[model samples]
Target chain A: MSPPVAPLGWSRWLVPPAALSVHLSIGQAYAWSVFKPSLESALDLSGTQSALPFQLGIVMLGLSAAFGGTLVERNGPRWAMTVALICFSSGFLLSALGAATEQYWLIVFGYGFVGGIGLGIGYISPVSTLIKWFPDRPGMATGIAIMGFGGGALIASPWSAQMLESFGSDNTGIAQAFLVHGLTYAVFMSLGVLLVRVPRPAKTAADGGPAPLEGVQVSANSAIRTPQFWCLWVVLCMNVTAGIGILEKAAPMITDFFADTSTPVSASAAAGFVALLSAANMLGRIGWSSTSDLIGRKNIYRVYLGVGALMYALIAWVGDSSKPLFICCALVILSFYGGGFATIPAYLKDLFGTYQVGAIHGRLLTAWSTAGVLGPLIVNWIADRQEEAGKSGESLYGLSLIIMIGLLVIGFVANELVRPVHARHHIPAQKEAVDVHERQQPA
Target chain B: MSTSDSSPPDSSPSGRRGLITFAWLWVGAPLAYGLYELVRKATQLFTG
Candidate 1:
């Protein structure tokens, strides 16, 4: 079906909330940690096994978004949001059944395979619509939605903890919690489905999206063939890997860095540090991305990559000596990580135009899937080897930090390599007219 | 994808303003709640 176009006088301000409804709901996937302990104990599974559902969910999130992005663009945000609501909620309900029956694979299939599709679809669903509605401020528009993704965990972490507390941390409790999550998100995400609207292309594109150069549109197919896309793919992957290196190991890394120092990070303080990282991650999604509107996407990425690399170097140079310095570096690194995500859609709009930008963004998220595994693996592997070598304190992370710095340097070079797409990549004007005709018609 | 619920119709100036308020609040309230909880947890870093 063709997406619902905005009514003649619909406020552009309304679009961000619609996008937020879906993003905030899917952001709950980050809170899988909240269920990990209970799943490990109640399901009688290994730590690796307990991680299966979440790991698979991340993997499938990338796969589905990559494959399903075109469908989202063709079908519109309303269709994509509805699909997300169904898949995400049902994944939860199915996991509830799995927990109740003591069948682990069911939970993985439900949450990872099925619900993961929801995460992916839900993620890129609004990009095209928001960019269409707020071409003047695509960075800020997308920042609000992506920020909701990081912030989703803040809400779900506490809410899920409370639910597990009330329901007890046993198998029955896990099942009930999953069920409630499924039902609750279904209801909440329905708001996005109801509220989202595509711009009426002929009219509203001029109304909301009237940049003189915007008419030069690139197809999703054409976008991938450009060197610009691959450069960004590497840029996103390296930036995310750097952030995840610290994020996945936040609590432990904090405590370890300061273990032999004057001021040790106690377990409680380490927990607090993780909370601070989340704050930076959430705020940077909106803050730095919005700032990109002022500074330009390329310059903003210089901060994320060049300055981000400097932050890693500072950590390496300082070692375990300074507590406050360590926290400051890590927080800035994470803000850039989140900013990279939030600013990317606008970056794509700048390079590709709004035509199929959502699909292109979807394709770009494969970098995230790769980084999700690559980030944790690089950090954990290096840390493990360092520990085996009798390294103590920040020494365990010494090699990992250097490798992260190398990755950031590579990413910084990639950022510098990005230039505007060649005119050959833009969709031929004659063909674009035909595609626009097909787009306006219901399929 | 079709749903019974539609954007709150904007027939007049006040009606449109009400919608802008309602729309922002729909998402903003929960986000504020999340931020509040996050701030509460983060304070332990300084305090503890």
Candidate 2:
């Protein structure tokens, strides 16, 4: 189960594809919404009941990443990828059986519980490896891996829709669809398992091979104890929450904002709007995070949070006055959201060094899980209350926008508060050597 | 960021270069297809 090590003069470029295979496959999580309507109609389920699988899947994503991060580091990417393939693919297979048997609980347990573990593990598997491979461009390397996650849905959304169209959206068809998905993804993700390689330790500590970085070699356990880690936690949570605000209700929000306008948006255009946001989300992961390599992580996050708050304000103050203006602002905000996710592993690499970055990154994902729930709850609950009070059009969303702005502002402050880790957190060189050796051997 | 271990230098052999090309194409082809489909869908915003 040990990871494959790169031979002398291995091309670092190969690493991103390995990482992308896993990321893109797990990214199918985002496309789950595409299946929601079909499931509801077929099973006579409520909207909320149909939503159970996706919500549980996200919750599991965070928990598994947090708990399994250290295990991933110890076992290496090969072992991690193999595990992800089994759990994730089996999740679909289980759902196939559930759909065939008409047992919704089985679908939830399979796709949400088992599949989500794959999402978490696959998400972080390539992060530290990419950081190690491209130490000089850590942000860009990690960006390439994470961008696949954002783009995964773009591929899956249409592909799944087409499959449902062909196979029929009824129980038997749904079973066939799930079966195909499981087999296809398992085959696709295998390339990553075959190709992943860890770098050979550098001849010198400065060369950034499995060595202590910037003289700060904090373990993941010690990292969680640092003020720096908590600050990033708040920062990531706030950023994700803010981005998810628009993302969660994008179609509805856009529709409501323009419902009373001279030119209200149609349903088709709203779907297009969602697709546009996905494009922006995927592009931002690569574009802005790569820019972080040039401009620095701190400065780029300042843009994500500080400028992000301003974008919310723009949307609020302008109301539904101009469609183009609203879209541009939302697009920028969503881009910042993607940039935040892509840049964080590099930020962890910066603050704690690479010794336990993947593990630390795993722990930090608890913030994403939190934001995933919090962002939608705050937006939806407030919108529901406003609607009850006879609010309509842009008025229903005004308060939600204000709350989003506040969250971004808090994130901005958290990003600013981040500083270098204290010396006490740095592992001594001898102990660091021993820990690295332990990491290399199979557990 | 202060770091080391660069990914690809200008110097490379043909065999390794071909493999790199293959690896990137393997991922890039799907990503590009997805992007094209997304862009096609997003065009509805203006067209509709």
Candidate No. with top lDDT: 2
After TM-score superposition, the amount by which residue A224's alpha carbon in candidate 1 deviates from its true location, in angstroms, is 1.1
Q: Best candidate per TM-score, number?
A: 2
Q: Rate the local accuracy (lDDT) of all candidates.
A: 0.88, 0.89
TM-score of each: 0.94, 0.95
- Native contacts recovered by candidate 1, as a share? 0.40
Could you give candidate 2's per-residue lDDT for residues A1-443 as a string of tens digits? Answer: 56677766777777889999889889999999888988998888999998888888888889889999999988788888998999999999999999999999999999999998998898889888888888789999999999999988888888899999999999889999999999999998998998898876443436434444445789999999999999999999999999999999999999999999999999889989999999889899999999999999999999999999999999999999999999999999999999999999999998998887899999999999889989999999999999999999999999999999999899889989999999988889767766665566544
Worst 10 residues of 2 chain A by lDDT: A202-211
RMSD of each: 4.1, 2.6
* Model 1, global lDDT: 0.88
Q: List the residue pairs that clash in candidate 1.
A: none
